[model samples]
Target: MPIRVDLLALEPNVPGRACLTVKKWQGGEEQLEFSIQRNQDGFYLQDQKAWSNNPFWFKVSRFALAASGEALEAQVGPEVVDPLLEGGANSQFQIELREQNLGHADKGVVRPGVGLLPSTAGGQTRSTYGGVDLSAPVVPEPEAEIPELPELFLPVAEPEPEPTPAPAEPVYTPPPAPVKKSKKGLIALLIVVLLLLAAGIGYWFYQRTPAPAPTVAAPAPAATNAEACTLDSMNSVPELTFVQTCIKAAPDSAKLLEIINQAKASKHCGVAQRLYANRAQAGDPLIANAYAREYDPKYLKASECFPTADNATAAYWYETILAQDPNNAEAKQRFEELQK
Candidate 1:
């Protein structure tokens, strides 16, 4: 026989909350809590608080069930759980059980009662012999009859039904007249003539335009001091003269910022350091250390000279300076101060 599981009650009052308490035959107890919400789609259980406007928002606390054989206990809530079944029948197991349809609007607390087995059943023996005690308080009747009542009669006041709406008049559509093949043929000929004319005009223009004087690019300007100071020159030059020229060309703070950016991009730490120092001397802290100091001392000193005793900033500069010039008394003292 096919096993049937029915949801006896689903109470969806107390919106935004759900809880279930179950007592197992082995004398174990479990509790579960969950939230409920509703949306345009349908009712659903949420792990967190659901909105008040949720149409499906309802709280369900208690549920009742009736089965053919022994009464089974189950944990209920938002979480899914495997159903308890009889005779070790895995196929009969119903999973993810939840209560349903006490009413859509009946949101309230439920305290379901669990029927207990009678003590006389082999004096609470492990195996209750051949048949289970149907009289047990835990097992309740599966069906209860609800009588239907006759409707009350009332004095009738008859009213005529409204007339049906008239159908709309149909619109008359005229069929398209057939085109003259002669006219179509003439139009086709004209289109072909226009295409040929366009092609002829294109060819004439192409021939008239002397192939754009083979654009002879002007010879590149002889490598000047400015061009020579490129990233490639940083390693070749002993003192970074190109970098100094760049600084000279950079007339104001705005230009200085640009030069600093170029130095950083080239990975010219030493040049970047000097650029920062220049910016610091000019009182531009934002540019000095922001890009340079994270590297070695040459970069750090440039950053240190910039005003601003920001602890993290000072720490990096002081550490870098001390690492390179351990004997430099000023650097050592600053390192010690920053460490503290």
Candidate 2:
């Protein structure tokens, strides 16, 4: 049966989230309900339980909002619509069509090319002196002569000596100005002596101060996840929450593997999913392949964690593995088979 999706409600006022109801057209009275929350890149599925029973369930890679007529619609996926139907069933939804529309004046018109030409001719013209007459005689101007003047004799007169005036009294001599002695150098030397005394007192106090006594720090107890939850607690409390936290808190891969094996033996199916998922996303090919098997159609029938198979999810994880290790034959084969 084809799947049907209906929009129930948009988040109040802000429109940050959308609630949707989905169901198979002829499947039964059963229906799936979930919410999608907006993120920076797009939107992500918030309710996993909505499609938990769907064998063809897959991750929506992207979502975009669109307006159709008067109503708004969310276009989701470039994913396979139906896993059972291969080839042409694979498609993507685009919100709107972008067309290159040219205006009436812009259509089929070619602009003319402009060529530059010189404003004046390039050849040289005749010089200005070329028009003047050069054939005239070269005449030189004559020098003029001046007349000489006669010499005249003049007599010298002798003057009589007058009485010498008395010498003026010597001006009173003023006493030399008193010399003032500078005290700047003396003051500077005193300041230096005071600084030295201060330094000596500081050294004396430092010498009298005794060194701190040596002490030892007590050793810390070895840290372990046992404090969070234990296998024994599983039988008593059986709380999945604590078990998951303990699984994440397990120190190394070896410890994590130990916890996963024990959890499986105790029939704790979902505990290992998050544990393996964390490492898979961190780019571990082996862990990613193991995580993929949890949803793989070939293996899900036997899995306690997943009752129904999801080829899309398994294919997604397989593709993740291939991205990191392209030569991985298992992941490549599984991904191709899922596509078919």
TM-score of 1: 0.20
Q: Write the per-residue lDDT of candidate 1 for residues 1-340, one digit (tens) a residue.
A: 1112221112322211122332122211222122332222233433232323333322334332324323333334322111111111001111122234322211211121111112233233221111112122245577744333333343343464664565597556453343355456667777876777677767766666676677798996744545544555556664335544545444466655665556666565456555554444333445433432443233443332232223333444443344455675755565456445
lDDT of candidates 1 onward, in order:
0.37, 0.41
Cα RMSDs of all predictions?
35.5, 34.4
* Tens digits of lDDT, candidate 2, 71-97: 223322212111101111111111111
In candidate 2, residue 144 scores what lDDT? 38
TM-score of each: 0.20, 0.34
Q: Cα deviation of 91 in candidate 2 (Å)?
A: 24
For model 1, the superposed segments whose C-alpha errors exceed 4 Å read 1-238, 251-258, 289-340
TM-score of 2: 0.34
